[model samples]
Target: MQKSITNQNQENIKGIIFMVSAVLILPFSDSIAKWLSSSYTTIQIAWLRFLIQAIILIILSFSLKYKITGFHKKFILVSIYISSSIVFLFWGLKYLPLANNIALFFIEPLVLTLLSVLILKEKLQKNHIIAVIIGLIGTLIIIRPNWSAYGMASIFPIVSAIFYALYLITLRQVSTKTNSKSLQFYIGVISTILLSVIIVVCELLNIDSFGFKQIDFNDWWLILLLGVITTIVQLLVSKAFFYSKASSLASFQYLEIISASILGWLIFKHIPDMLTIIGAIIVISSGLYLISHERKNSKT
Candidate 1:
């Protein structure tokens, strides 16, 4: 079916756009979260973030009569993995600089790519393999191998990478019949519910980690910004996965490092050293070429 191929090609192109936008914009959200972490507990920040995200998405998805319907049970697992990932990531962000936190988390793309092929049964073409490898090399160069110094903070991101990679894999498996908005809404809702239960349970059990402190109205704006960014990014990521293989989408994640670097320097005055800049250049060049190649092939 020529028409089918054409449709899939268009979807592939859109997928690339959506995935790239998600990765790039997500860093801004991460930057904000890192800044906020100093003033809030990770569980406190995470539960509230998911709540705001759920609220925003529920409003945006109001028109979808069946906004939270028909997803596989696997989505529950997806919610757990993602919530765990976020909790771990926020812990890392609180202790690590924005760029370093993001660099360490970049390992998710590699983990996702591996799971895509080995677990999801997606074909890993030579070019994709090359793209992911190049992306990692660039990421490693940026971090420059001083990971041990970050200590426990660094370990959190690694754990996050595993959870996030599993989250994406599970999401891809369950997104075939699901539209992006509804899927995003479902995740927001489920994740919100999951985190709420966790936070409450921690409180009931006399766990002091996520205790609710006196509220500050001032921080609501930052929380709103995070919700908006996360909601929109999740929409894009859901769309991307709806249109492309998990492995194909992973390479685009490297673009986040560049954004993280710029946002870090601008907001926190954490300048990127020479190696970071060079690594970013390598990542973008290879990523752009891969995108162009995919587009040309799709046209053919």
Candidate 2:
């Protein structure tokens, strides 16, 4: 049992690393999609992204011998989660700056904490409350809310975050009985099917046109990279929750903000202003403390 616990910890650590790396890669993918967003509709970009993800997920599931069936009851909730996530995220990418969009996503952990306390009856530790406060302070720094600077684009990601939190809470409830890979696979598959239906209906109704911009061959590499890397990342994140509490792993998501700010500045020549930087630090620090606290409590 001791050895088993140690092994699980090691796996969780690896999952954390993969998840953080994936979070780092995500901003770049968003940048790419956002660049394409001007010419392409939101559903077009979403379908393309999910189609690629679905293909990669199928291959991985088969190769790893992960079952993709069962868990019928969880499908509706999972579908709602992924569909809402894809649409809102793509739409947010369309209108908001990359850094701003990502910073708002940080709220997801706080949302998860609230859900756990309310729905799951999980008590928040002292550190959990402190972390949340610190994280919120960090968010305020990033948004620096002013009467003059608000826009509808900012609200989309917040809605996305809320939907994502609900998704996480539902996953936490179901994860103990079902396999993590299966959960990830079902999400990808469901999202793919839903997207396909939406694409066909849109085509029929002439609601919007999908522009298949003949790619420059080289860009196809990035698209493939985006698909494969994201699939692997999703699998790793799913597995992470197997060993750690969803609420525990959820807080570490704040690390993505630091990664996004650095990447956004380095690749896009976009720098977060002083307030954003201060907020990022507060969120990151509090989130780290929350994770550590959870780990310590779990051991005791």
Candidate 3:
């Protein structure tokens, strides 16, 4: 019993480390994407991100002898859902401050909680309902709908959150049956293909799609860093889940908001207003409470 408890503690520690590292690195990729969005279209950026990730995944699969199995229709849907979320996030990043974007995107957890209740028929715990309401109120505070300052771009993150929630729900369904490497590779391939088609259609239509921009040597490095960091962070997050329960690791994700805020201030001279800061605090508190509530329920 003592040995089992020690092992679990070790796993939790490792999971915390992995999750913290991933969250810290994630903001850098978002900052890069926001910077690149200035020069490239969202579709173009999404395509490159997935293309690079797919290439690396393919190489890793071969070297590691990871089998590429599972070619279900749900794989395609997951790819599209995730791809759409990325595109919307990049689009919003163009106009929104990084902190604001992160805060709004934080609604994803709440959305996921709601979906679990609705789709999975999980018990609608009272604490969860309260958490969801608090989270939405925090989101509204950041968005400040009365002011209408962010305009249509404000809607992008909300849309992204919805798609992201759907992605998580779908991921839950497919994850049990598929190997993680195989699942990621399939999603990457499908996303790359879908984005490539969008790019081609934009080119053919001669539309004002944020069509591909010329990549200078300097810009090439930034784009490469974006893809590599994203892939690494994702792997770390997966490893974290492997090491510990998802509920135990949930609170660490808010680190991204802090990291994003600091990065935004340093890189773009963007600071969250008083209201935005307050909203972020509220959102984080609600999320933490929800995680604690879930943990307690699991224990019982």
| Top-scoring candidate (lDDT) | 1
TM-score of each: 0.93, 0.85, 0.83
Per-residue CA lDDT of candidate 1, range 248-291, in tens?
88888889887899889999999999999988888887688679
Q: Which pairs of residues clash in candidate 1, taking residues 3 or more apart in a chain or in different chains? A: none
lDDT of each: 0.84, 0.71, 0.77
Question: How many clashing pairs does model 2 include?
Answer: 1
Q: For every candidate structure, what is the RMSD over all alpha carbons to the true structure, in angstroms?
A: 1.9, 3.2, 3.7
How well is each residue in 149-235 modelled by candidate 3, as lDDT tens digits?
788887898799789778766776676666667777787889999988888787878876655666777788988888898778767
Question: Higher lDDT: candidate 2 or 3?
Answer: 3
Pairs of residues clashing in candidate 3: 41-210
Reference-based TM-score, model 2? 0.85
Pairs that collide, model 2: 138-279
- Displacement of residue 233 (Cα, Å) in model 2 is 2.3
lDDT of 1: 0.84
Candidates, ranked, TM-score:
1, 2, 3
The deviation in Å at residue 73 for candidate 1 is: 1.6
Model 1 Cα shift for residue 49 (angstroms)? 1.4
In angstroms, how far off is 235's CA in candidate 3?
Answer: 3.6
